[model samples]
Target: MEPHLPTTIQISAPQHAANNPYRVIEGEEVLSVAFREFVLTAVAAGWKEPEVALTLADIADDYVMALARRAAAN
Candidate 1:
């Protein structure tokens, strides 16, 4: 019998801030997928820039929900 294998994932942020002043803050999320796919999605979705500049609390709920959905799928 074969045992189930766990999925290994990692997320990271930029080491420093972006140079763009329009970006109140800059960071990144690293997913374990094909580099091309990741870059394409980020570029197409325009998630590379901050959509809104607000406190972390403002987006915490939505972020948590997103994390939950991703976790559930895995």
Candidate 2:
């Protein structure tokens, strides 16, 4: 595969982000950039696409389950 720069995803709701005290707008942007860099680095270092996808899904699943557990507790 030809080498290309990883793209950063732009946050669409900067105003809403600013209104939310729990999440900083700049922090989200930085995390996105960092995530892209990590993915690019992983691919460059011989990680397969499936592995990367599975990792992402696992992370998302963990987050979702944590939320679910919190809701149940509440």
Identify the leading candidate in terms of lDDT: 2
Candidate that would win on TM-score: 2
- TM-score: model 1 vs. ground truth: 0.25
Clash pairs detected, candidate 1: none
Evaluate candidate 1 by giving its C-alpha RMSD to the native, one decimal.
13.6
Per-residue CA lDDT of model 2 for 1-74, tens digit only, reads: 76666655443445445567756856677668767777777777679877986898799899999999999999
Q: Rate residue 30 of model 2 by lDDT.
A: 63
lDDT of 1 by residue, 1-74 (tens): 34434433344555554776534333322332433354444445544424322333367678999999999999
Return the lDDT, model 1, position 23: 40
Worst 10 residues of 2 by lDDT: 7-16
**Reference-based lDDT, each prediction:** 0.49, 0.74
